[model samples]
Target: MRNKYAIVIICIVALVIIEKENNIILRVSDKLSQFRTLQMPETSSFVIIDDNSSYPDDIYSENVLGAREKGQKHILLMATTRSGSSFVGEFFNQQGADMFYLFEPLWHVEAMLSLGTNGTNSSTSPWVYRDVLKHLFLCDFSLLERFINPPPKDHVTPDLFRRESSVALCENQVCTPVIKGIFEKYHCRTRRCGPLNLTLASEVCQKKRNRVIKTVRVTQLDTLRSLLEDPQLDVRLIQLVRDPRATLASRIVAFPSKYQDWKSWAVNENVSVKEEEVKRLEGNCNNIRMSAELGLSLPKWLEKRYMLVRYEDIARDPMQKAAEMYNFTGIPFTPQTRDWILENTHSHSSGIFSTQKNSSEHVEKWRFKIPFKLAQFVQEICGPTMKLFGYRFVDNEQSLVNKSFSLLEEKKFHFS
Candidate 1:
């Protein structure tokens, strides 16, 4: 079944790739049509990369050879999954007319070119890298429209506008505007090691005339420190974050893996609700500790570079929050764009389920669904951290101490 599912997904992805590459121009997004589809809730931690997007061809017939932005705009939304990041990305995609939509870049990026442990003979070599980047630079924007508001039944939307993304001429076959740019054109030719340096890749990107590239992990902050440390690198970060509670709830599956010991992360359903608090608290504590470790490891310059976002605010009200996000990042937010967002912002959940249309409120539904013991454990372990976040415990240590003190007072009264 798993294999079948995987095959289905791959086939669907393949269809999208073919449709976009061969399709004609695109104009109004709403006028395009969808082919193969993925079942998605109105809200999910999901993104649609237009290049791999499939749609009914040609509604807008603008030629790319002479295409110009006329002051075209670009904005990259960077964030991890289950963090309201996709919602943010989608909002940017909704901006002024049809624009580029690069879904999670790192997502399954390994499937792209793999620079083997030492960059040698490998299956799915060099070509993977070329194809992935090509998709980014030249994916169909019109196909992406159906994704934003795919028809309720299966209607064709404004597709001809997609062809407008490119410039008229092939700029060196692979170096200029992506559509005709010619940098890594020969990527199909497997060249021996040492030539595919990061410096060259950055230069390639710069030459492409890209304004902003969106990715989370602060590539410059914590994880990619080594890459950023190189003297030749010049990287700007679009740091995005969400409320801790929401972030965790969204990643419950991944949280348990971070524990140093399985026992520390384990819980027994047989335990009383009161008995489970210890385990829940332990998990929350460890999660908090991990974030702290990452924060501490973060470069001092990172704090200044980041724009903090509480996912809750985004989920509750995306327009206002998206505006704040754009404002903080120094990206312009106009009424037309804002109006677009007001019209198209669909996600409602950045919590675990991460639906597509809106962010989720299941942030801490665990308090109710979790065993009482687990709840108590979480409270006890995360009490201090929760307090810092202004969360009050239903069962608190102070109450426990007060109860003990009351018993002592009664005993003293009887003795007297």
Candidate 2:
């Protein structure tokens, strides 16, 4: 009886051990598959793992690597018009990700303030605008409510409201009310209004996982220095620049009529400077000045939190540059993000501001479309800044006049 009992006890122990081993094996297999899906190329430049490391965790796990820290972070994308701000902004709005991203939330406010409409006064200076933006960045909608209370006249049309994050978040309890306020202020003018309390907007914003705000209105980095100093907010600024010649070429393509009119005025008047010339020149100079200020004037503590990205560089190798950006911002650049980049970039280049296309072909477009004399003029206007950005001037002219005409026709067809 004693020997039988011993055998029974031994059998039970062996079964328990086998089950534990099976569980361990399953977990190991699951982890391996996760890494396999990431399928990060062995030669990937942005891979966090060292070649010699035997385990993935030797460097850092996915959770600890990117923007998944315990506290909330505010990522501000700073760039000028047609500087690819939208493209960069989309990086944070990964497909199937829950992110609070505001696309030009200040647009309505600016329009209303500029027009002096909805009982607004002309006293709204840039500093006041900056302060309002600062509060909005901090998820304080109360201050923003004052500027856009009556809603701007242009808010409904041209689909400005459609581009906002609030529209995307209507189904979400956090964003529904805030969005409703815009429509409610205008007597529910559009069909997008939904039932929700707008008061909770601030609460939702404060606890959002990743609150990203992008603005092209800013011309100085110092204007946002206060945001960096805010203890409650973890802020990051991405200073995006493009080659000036390319920027000029794109502007011509987008506003061919405007440029042509300006050119005609210049020729007829025999004047180098037209009425809009100074404004355009100052805008470009201000962009360059902002770039310089961010690099030189910013304190060391704030400097570490800033990233300067070039449109040319990103266009050349988007994935690698995107990885670098994600790393800098503490946001995880996952396999899904890689797929998103590939999908968005692999297309024929387009000149229209609203459209996206073959990113690789976007580099050096100015060389083919912009005339040599005009290019030289742009170089003179943006000389030092161009040098600062390391963009070389191409003396050789390769005017694709026929191609430009064809492109303009296409632009008219699509945009007109």
Candidate 3:
């Protein structure tokens, strides 16, 4: 009877030990579950459903997330020189007090680096441009300071390369106080204000809800993959393209000194495909075509992030395109922005860099300006890019100059 009692006592002890081990394991699992919950982003929520019927009917629907209702947005307005980028950039710049706009910050980069022995080749490196842009987007101006020509003295520089273009930079708070009795009306804010206070600029940037940087210096789109994929930044890219013939025509007029050779060719009618200028044009078109292919492929990183806008499309209908862009970036279309667009688009002001113009008339003005031979040469070299972007080719000078002859096809480009 005592031996039987001993066996029962041993079994009871084994059961108690097993229960204790299970309790410990349960406690550890609970702690792990809490940790995972804490790791999730605050902006998103999770729900568990036990029944098959609980699933939403539109689970497979596209763009169900719609525009971002919350969170900060970073916008990059990407385009080439003389592609009507400055005009498009105004759509964002005119977004009232909430926007912090930077026009061609990379201008300083190119200008400073070209003075070095390596010339523009080193300055235009995608890596270097990307690093600078990353810093600027994060509201850090120290990286940009290195490239400022006069070397920002104590974080202040008078020559910031088109300081007037950004309204945020010209605000009374960011700029130094005007001298006593200085007529503010006579001089523009950029001139009235002393050297730009970068420290103050950074502070202003941090307070703003949106940051926009427009640049023509970034030549390749694939170079921006890392920036697009950054976890900390919600980046949106807008690529603006114009017809090669029109672009060449505008460049010739805007940059006469640089395009003297092209002007000579147009005048002399001695255009050749083998010329260095023609080869350069071919390279530019190829680069644009390659970038478009990458963006259109809809890579995992760029889904709902890349947008292609034709300069002609926006020029034809500024308000509609402006609204679409604002929707893409999740920025509200305010009254102030609409008013500015109304005034600028209808105005007759035409300066080399001025955003104000009769946009619809400006789109086709190049057709009348460029020679027929020059147009043909551009079409021959940029045939693939033109077709990709829906630009119609012309057969003769008469067709090119005909007001009713439309050069643009009715094609829609939307990524979202």
In model 3, the clashing pairs are none
Q: What is the lDDT of residue 33 in candidate 2?
A: 41
Instruction: Report the C-alpha displacement of residue 278, candidate 1, in angstroms.
Output: 13
lDDT of 1 by residue, 2-25 (tens): 999999999999999878744422
- Candidate 1's displacement at residue 340, Å, is 4.3
Point out where model 2 deviates above 4 Å. Answer: 1-69, 95-98, 117-124, 152-204, 256-260, 263-276, 296-298, 349-351, 396-416
Q: Global CA lDDT of candidate 2, please?
A: 0.57
Model 2 residue 300 distance off true place after TM-score fit, in angstroms: 2.9
- lDDT digits (tens) for residues 1-416 of candidate 2: 99999999999999999998676545434433433343322322122112222223322232223433465667888887777778877777652344567777676556545544333333323444455455555555544443443422322222333333443334355323334234333222333444333345555555566677787776667655655655445678888887776776677677877667544543465645565675676566666655555554557647557877887677778888889777777666777768878888877756486435678776656566666666667767777777666666545454333333321111100000
Using lDDT as the measure, the top candidate is: 3
lDDT of 3 by residue, 269-318 (tens): 56433477778899999988888888877788899899998999999999
Model 1 clash number = 69
CA-only RMSD, every prediction: 18.8, 25.8, 21.4
Select the stronger candidate by lDDT from 1 and 2: 2
Assess each prediction's global lDDT (C-alpha) against the native: 0.37, 0.57, 0.78
The lDDT, on a scale of 0 to 1, for candidate 1 is 0.37
Worst 10 residues of 1 by lDDT: 407-416
Question: What does the lDDT come to for candidate 3?
Answer: 0.78
